[model samples]
Target: MLVRQCKSNFLGWIVPLLLLSITVHTAALAQCSPGAIICETFGTGTRGQLPQGQTNFSYRAIPCPNDGEYNVMDTVASSCHGDAWHRVTEDHTAGDVRGNMFVVNASYQPSEFFSQKAEGLCPGVTYEFSMWVMNINKVLQPGPCDEFSLRNPIIAMRIEQTDGTLIREVVQPAVPRTTTPVWVQLTMQFAIQTNVNDVVVKLINKGLGGCGNDLAIDDIGFRPVHPTLTIQFPNSTATETTVCADTRLTLSVGAATGYPNPVYSWQQSQDNVNWTAVPGSGQATYTINPVRAGRTYYRLRNAQPINANAVGRSQCSAESNVLIVNGRPDAPFSIGDDLALCEGTSQVLRAPEPLPAGTTIQWSDQSTNRQLTVDAPGNYWLETNLNGCTYRDTINVAIQNCHLEDIYVPDAFSPNSDTVNDKLVVMHPGTFTAYSFRVYDRWGSVLFVSKQADTHWDGTFQGQPCLQGVYAWTVDYSVLNGQNQERHFARSGRVLLVR
Candidate 1:
C-alpha cells in the first residue's frame, strides 16, 4: 500500500512519518540508492516483432534472422542458426515468464540502434542507468571458425543533454560467448546538472559484423542514486530503535538532503511482503492512527514529483528499510513447578499478583479467584491483562511424596509358592541417592545382597532354602535432604525368616 504519512505510538511515544522537501546540492555523479525512477522491463510476453528503433538495420518478424536485422522474442532455438547460437531459454529479468529480449545480429558497419529522450528528472539528482545483456553465440562452434578467431558483441551507451552536448559515455568491452546464455548487467551513473530536467539516452554498436557477435538485451532501469537517505532513531549510535507504547515521536532524515524537491511515501504492513501506504498529502508532516498492540512494519519512500515514465505510470520511488514496532507491558511473574506435598495435604496456587489497578486475571480452571485450591498434581495456567497488554503463562506440577523416615525394610518373609509375604524387599517414600540391603548368616557369611529398591531376596541361599531361624540384616543408604545434599544412614537388625 502507498501513503505519504503514517504514525505509531511507541509506549506513549507517537512516531510520525514525514515527507521532507530539502535543498539540492551540486549534481556530482556518485553512489546508488536502489529505487526505480525509470525502468523499462520490456514488459511481459513475446512481441514476435521488431521494437521501434533508430537503427539502419532491418526488422525481422521471425525469431531468427540474418545480419543487419533484430527481433524481440522470448526464446530462440539453438538450432535456429544451424546450431551456432546459444539457446536462450528465458529472459534476463528474473521471474519474467515468456518475457521478450531484444535480439540483434551485428551490421556489416557499426551504427546506432537505440536513442530516446528522457525528461522530468529533478535537477542536481544523480541517477544510475543499467541494462542486462547476454551474448547469444555458443562458445564452441559448428562452423570452421573457432572462438579465438571470431568476433564478439560490443555495445556503447551514452548520455547527453537534449541539444546533444555529451555528459558521459560508457562503451562496453566485447561481450564474450558462453556455452550457455550468461547475462551481464551494465551500469553507469550520470548527474543532472543545475536547471537540467531532460537528457537523451542512446545505444550504439561498436563490433564488426561476424558469425559470433549476436546478442540480446533486456530490463533497462534508471533512478536517482546519490546522497542516500538513512532513517534511524535518536542516539543513532545505539542499535535500540524501540520506543514506549502510545507515545508520539517525530522521525526525520535530520541533515539537509541534496536532492532537489523530492516526494515522500509512507507505508506499513503486517507481513513485510504486502504493504499499504500511509495516507497524507505531499507535505512535510502527517498523522497516522494510533498503532495497534502487536508488531507493525513500516517504511518511508522517497521519489521525485516530476513525471518520468515509471513515475507517470507507477511513480519513481525508492523505499526504506522496514521499521518494526512492538507494544508491551513489562509485567513479568512466575509460579513454582515440581512441588512436594505431604500425605493428605493440599496447597494453594496464586495467579501472578501484586498487580496494578484495573488488572484482570483468569485461571485455567475457569476460576476468577486470585488463589486456587489444588488437591491433585497436574498442570495449571493463568491469563492476565493489565492496562492494554495481555499475557498467558503456564506451569506443570508433579506429586513428590516425602516421609519423616527415609527408608523402610521388611522385617520378615517366607519363600512359599503362595503369594504371601514371600520376599524380603526395601520400601521408601523418599527419593534415593544410594542404597545396599543385605542379609548375613550366623557365621558372618553374606547370604543375600541387592542394590535396587525394587529387588528382593527369596529366603534362599544360592538354590537352597534358608534354615527356619532368625537372620541378621543390615542396610547402608543415602537420601537427598532439603538442600539436595546426601545424608548417610545405616541400620542393622535380626529378622526371623520362615522358609
Candidate 2:
C-alpha cells in the first residue's frame, strides 16, 4: 500500500478546517445505495440514521467491494472542541480513510460493501483499494472510548471468498493518528483470485479501543464487480396490501440492487406458503380477479437473483399484511348516504355491525394514528386496506347544518348602499351551514326568502317600496356536532323597515 496525504491550508483553524469534511450516512428511509443495498449513511446534516443536532460522515454500497469501498461511522470526544484539531485534545468528527485497505476500529462500526463474487485476475491486473480519507477531528483521548488506546480508526477492509469466508485482511495506518487533521493514505497490492468464483471485499467499523470515535465515508466502490451487469433492482413495496378480493393491488419499488433495466415478476398464492405467477403482466401489481373468500398472498420475483451465486440468493417476498373477504354487510347495515356539516363537524362515513369491545376498526385513512374526526364537508373514503376479504369500504360526505350568529338590528336603517352594514342583514351569535331565511308582513304574506345573506333587504318588496314598519322573519338551520346526526333550530325575530 502507498501513503498519500491531502491537507488544507487552514490546518489549525477549527471552523474553516471542518468545512472540508466529506460524509455519507444513510438508512432505509434515506437515499438508496448502489445495488439497492440499504445502509445508515448520514451526511453533514441530520438525516436518516445519522445523529441529530450533530454532523457525522456516512455512505453505503449495494454489495461489498472486492478491492475496497468507503466506510461511514461516528466518534465523539469532549476535550478539544472544534472542527479540526491542531493539537490532540477533544472533539468528535466523522469521516473516512483509504489505503491498500482499511479496517474498522473496535469502537465505532462502519457500513460495509462486498462484491457479488470474486473474479480471476488477468495479467498485470492488481486489485487496488483507496479511499478519499477525511479525518473530521484529530484529538487525543480524554475519557473512555475517546481514549485511543489502540491506534486505529473505526474502519476495516477485508476480502472474502465465494463461500463468504475471509481470505485476506487489508491493513492501514491509524487514521487521525497525527494531532493535525490530514489524509494519511496507505495502499497494498493483492493478486486477484484464480479459483475465485466470486469475491466480496468489505469496509466496516470495529469498536476502536471500545471508546467513542467517528468518521464518514463516500464513493466506496469496486470498479469492476461485474463487466456485463451494470445495474440492479431496487427494493419494492406496495402502496397498499390487504384489500377486498376484487380490489386492485398496487406495488411500489423502493430501491433496486445491481444494474438498471432489470425484469420484475409478480406472483400470487392462496396460502402464503404457495405462490403462482400472475399472468400477462410483469409489473409490480397482481389484481386478484374472482378473488376467493379468504386471504391471498403476493410477492415480487426478480428475473435474476441479486447475488447470482450467493447461498439462498436474495429471495424478495413479503406476506400480505392481511385482508378479509366478507361479502357486503347485510342490508342498510352497510349501504347509506351521509350529510355534511360545518367545516368542523364530525361525520360518520361508515357504521359497521356491533362487535366486541376493543374490536379495532381499520380504515383507508390509516387514521389509526388519531380518532376519526370529520370537521368539514367533502368526499371521504375509508377501508380496512388489509388482506381480509371483508375489510374494505368507501363513503361520501355531505352536511346539512345551518347556524345563525344572532345579530341585533337597529330600529332605524338608512336604505343607503354604503359598503359598511348598508342592508338589514341577519345576525346570530353561533355558526351554521346550509341555512334558509324568510321574511313576512303582519298578514303572513312571504316578502323575502334567501339562502345566503350576501346583502340584506333594501326596504322594498317586489319592486314596490314598503313604508317603514315592523316585519317578522324566521330562520331555519341545522348544526352538525361531532356526530352523524344533525341538530335543527328555528327562530323568529322582528326588524323595523327604515327609510
Candidate 3:
C-alpha cells in the first residue's frame, strides 16, 4: 500500500498548472551609468541567436561547455524584462524562442557553462558587474522515493583571462526548488591587473540534476569605476595666498571612493617650473615645518596609481595655487640705546623705517602705531610680525631727578628797563617743582616777593624803583634728584640795585 501511494503522489502535480500562465511584475532594469565600456541587456537581436557580441559552444553533445546550452526566452513566466531574457537549457528549448529558461541536467552531463567575452577593457582599471538570475524549478508531485528529488544547482559568475584563467569568481548558493520562479540579483566588483586587456565573463552551473536545474539571467553590465580625490585644506582656490612664515602648515587629501591604501607625495617649487619632492612627506596628510618665507608653490602626486587607465590620469596629480609665505621683518630695530628723562618729561619712541608692506608693529603697551610716547621710565619693547615671523626690540629708559647744581641765579640787575640785566632771575637746566624769591630792605622789612622760579625781581619795593644800594634777597626751590627724590634748596645774596 505504501508503494502504491508513493507512486500515485509522484505522478500528480504539487501545484496547479493554471498558475504558470500568470505573469510576474519584476522591478525596472538596473543599468550602469554613462561611460560604461560594455552594457548587455540581451534585449536586442533575434530570439534564437546569441546576444550581439556573445557566442555559444561550438562543440557537440556530452561534455558540452560549462556554461551549458542557452537561448533567449520571451515567455512571460521566465523573461526578466520587456519580453526577453537569456535562458540556459539542457534540451527542450534548443534552437527555439519557446524555451526561455536555462536548465542543467547534470544527470547526463557534469559541467555546463555560458560565457561572454568583453573587449576594450583597460589594463589596471576597476570595473563593476551586475546581473539578475532566477531559479525556474516547477513544483512536482511527491515521489515514491527521494532518489528522483529535485537537486539545486550551484551557480557561479567568473571573470577570466583570454586563456580561461580565473581572475575573480562570485558564487551563489544552490537555487532551491520553489513553487513560483523568483529572481535573484548578483553583483561583483574587481580591478584589472596590469597588462590585462580583455576578459571573459562566465556563468557556470555545477550541480547533479535529475530534477530542477533551471536558471534565467538578465540585465548584465560592465563599467569603469571613477574615484575622486580632492585637496581639502590650504585651499588653492581661496583669494588669500599668503601664509605665516615659520609656521607649520598641513595639507590634506580627501577621497570619495576607490583605493584602500593610496600613496601620496608632496612637492614644492619656488618658480613653479622646477619642483622638488619634500623628504618624509608621503601620506594623506603632510605638514611643512617652519615654512620658508617668500612666494612658493605646492603640488600633490599620487605615488600609487589608483588606475592605470588613461581616463584617470588627470586626477592622479593636483597642482596648488601660489603660496606666499610672509616672513618676519628684520630684527634689531634701532630705537637708540638706553635713554634718560627728567621727571614730568616724555620721549618719543619711533619704529625703524622702511617697513614692509602688510607688516604690523606693536609696542609692549599693546599700541599698534609706529611711534609711542613714553613718560615713565621702564623697559620699552616693540614687536613686528610679517608673513608669520615675529621680531622684537627693547630699550631701557631711566627717569632721574633734577640737580640744584645745574641752576644759576643772578643777584645784580638794573631796573632802568634797558632790556638787559633788567631783573634778577633764576635759571635751571631741568624742571622745577616749587620756587620762591624774596627781597628785604636794609631795615630787615620785606620789600618784594615772587613764587615762580621763572619770575624776576625788578629791583622794586611796592611797585616803586628802589634806590641803588645793597639789598638782601633770598630764593628757595625744590628739584627732583638722580633717584627721582625731591630736594629743597635755598640761597641768600646781597645785590646792588642801580637806577
* Candidate 1: regions farther than 4 A off: 1-34, 38-45, 50-56, 80-82, 93-96, 140-149, 235-246, 250-319, 326-499
Per-residue lDDT of model 3, residues 314-353, tens digit only: 2223333333344332333567888888778999999988
Predictions ranked by TM-score, top down? 1, 3, 2
Clashes of each: 21, 110, 14
| Tens digit per residue, CA lDDT, model 2, 132-168 | 3434345556544355363345455566765667776
Question: 9-34, model 1: which lDDT tens digit per residue?
Answer: 00010011111121222221121124
The candidate that wins on TM-score is 1
lDDT score of residue 317 within candidate 3:
34
Better of 2 and 3 by lDDT: 3
TM-score to true structure, per model: 0.48, 0.25, 0.36
* Best-performing candidate as measured by lDDT: 1
Candidate 3 lDDT (Cα, 0 to 1):
0.56
- Please say which candidate is ahead in TM-score: 1 or 3: 1
